[model samples]
Target: MKPTDTQRLLRRMFDAAIAAAQPALCVPPLLPPAPKGRLVVIGAGKASAAMARAVEQHWPGPLSGLVVTRYGYAVPCERIEIVEAAHPVPDAAGEKAAARLLQTVQGLGADDLVLCLISGGGSALLPLPLPGLTLADLQALNQALLASGASITEMNCVRRHLSAIQGGRLAAACHPARVLNLLLSDVPGDDPIDIASGPTVPDPTTCADALAILRRYRIRVPPTALAWLESGDGESLKPGDLRLPLIDTHFIATPQRALEAAAAVARQAGLHAHILGDAIEGEARDVAKALAGIALQTVRRGQPFQSPCVLLSGGETTVTLKGQGRGGRNVEFLLALAVALRGEPGIHALAGDTDGVDGQEEIAGALIGPDTLDRAWALGLNPRERLDANDGHGFFEALGDAVITGPTLTNVNDFRAIVIDGPPTEAP
Candidate 1:
């Protein structure tokens, strides 16, 4: 069966994401040859399990450790145990796994080696609440932050302050040991500290900044958390810290690399590809509106790249949930973009999470074409109402346009493509 253009483009995008996240493709062979003492592997993220498996396959020496991944994202490993946990929200399973990981890393000698696999969603997968704070407190704050449309950096900043094993504290616990972090960045800026809340990386955000985030979002943190933030007692590991001297962090996968891969795929498809910044952040709808304006210009005036081109972008987008319907930022962005386009012909678009889930829903994201608005009207669905109710998933699902890939096992972040066919004169 011949695949549609949209299908081909989406497959290319997914392939790019996978290529950028592959552990074997990213892990170095000569990584400070096996230490004389024990080699312990510890990590948490959507991609950590796969990364850990890759490490074991490549390392010449026997290794043992644990890594926590989102449920259904686990890959079989012979030595390193893969634990499944919740994502975008913390659960008791994740909490226990995080506690155990901390215990496993403690008291390592200078001769020992610690390989840490860090990736997106580690913040929630490794949920160890600070002293005097309950898991419920962290859960509540997480829910609030997700709904608040806070950027990943802001959310992670708040999480680091409230967690027992985040923000460089994890690395500090492995004192005297050689720590090497293999990171897959899902955050917009690919900041090592922001990914997975920087479990092993030095945190540059301050407690005051975390408190400001809480205030900005009106999130109710625990009294203990509040006091810690107010007192500025729990500072994260800083640069030049003696304990950090032996730690090395390597970014294995990033949004930029993923975008470039997607761009390459577009070029292969005989379409000119333009990659916008890979670190874009803001409210989803606003970003969609801005992108829609640019896309319109490219289609109408031929200003950007010309016809038969695809504008590809990657990063995490935010959505402030005000409605009761299911919605992911990618879908929300598409919905807003569709509304703005108002059925402009000869343009098709796809936006989705590389992890194959969007905003707690099973759908990755949705696709939009020139007929999207018309099709919705035919189905008697009001696109504006759905967008107003934060029902992007619902709207797309009704049209059978929602793409469901079911846990791709890797997460770089949101992948978006705006395909503009030839000018209006080239219409069939």
Candidate 2:
């Protein structure tokens, strides 16, 4: 039996995310031989636990350590302990887990090896606030940032300043030990330090950058945090830090790889695939509007590409919240796209997070047809109101259009595709 379009699109998204997180797909076989002393595994992110499991499976030497992931993202790992924590927001579990991870890496000698499995969500998963800043302070700042529509880079620049373990501080803690960081990139540009806030990599971002981001967002951070920023006391490890002499980092999976996978799938499905970009960023709604414009151009002019082609993109998009309803960035993007399309014919689209959860919601994302708004109206739902409420989950759920794939155990950020049919047709 042939798969439905939704099924095909979902499978493509899942395949893309997994492909971007796989170890063999990422880890080089010719890594310098393991050090003579103890080998410790440490990490934090939605994909960290799975990455740790992959490492345990392939490593020929004895390894022991711990990694923290969002609740329910854990995979069974005998050698490495997996701790589940909160994401997009920090909790005491995340705090405790981060503390343990810090203690685990300390005091290692030069002969020892520290394998760091870093990925998206680590920024929240490893929320170890610096001196004079409380977890509550960080939490409030995180909430403000989430609703500020700030780009991840901007948000992470702020986080790096507030964190004790991020911006290469974690790697620095294991000074004199050989640190090998294996990452699954979810941030645009694949800057190693930006992925999971660069817990295991040096950060070039400065206190001034963080302060500027806060000012741009008009977020009122704790006075202590501001003072720390002014003091420049939180500066992260720099490129010339002698402690990083033996450190090595590799990006195992990235949005680029995920987009390529989706492109391959689109070709197999008899469609020409044009990848707009793998690192697109900005507000979800604005991005949708821009994407809709391109999609319309493709249909009307056939200048960008011919019909029977799919526009594919992958990256993490941000949603600046103006409403009290629950919504993920992917859903916000889809809702915005639907409104812009204005019930245009022959277009179908899906936008979702690769990790099977969008923002803080359980649903991965949603799908929309040309009739998305019409379907909602027929059901007496107000698409615009829901969009305003940031209620993508509620809106899609009411239409039975929400995509739910629980804990895929990987993360590469967002996956979006727009499929334009051969031509416009009468209303079905």
Pick the TM-score winner. 1
| lDDT, candidate 2, 11-68, per-residue tens | 6755665665665556555244778999999998998887877777788888899999
Provide the clashing-pair count of each candidate structure: 0, 0
lDDT of 1 by residue, 18-65 (tens): 677666677655355888999999999988888888888888887889
lDDT of each: 0.86, 0.85
Spell out the clash pairs found in candidate 1.
Answer: none
How far off is model 2, as Cα RMSD?
2.8
Off by over 4 Å in 2: 1-14, 17-20, 23-32, 423-428
Where does candidate 1 have its weakest 10-residue lDDT segment?
419-428
- Provide TM-scores for the models: 0.96, 0.95
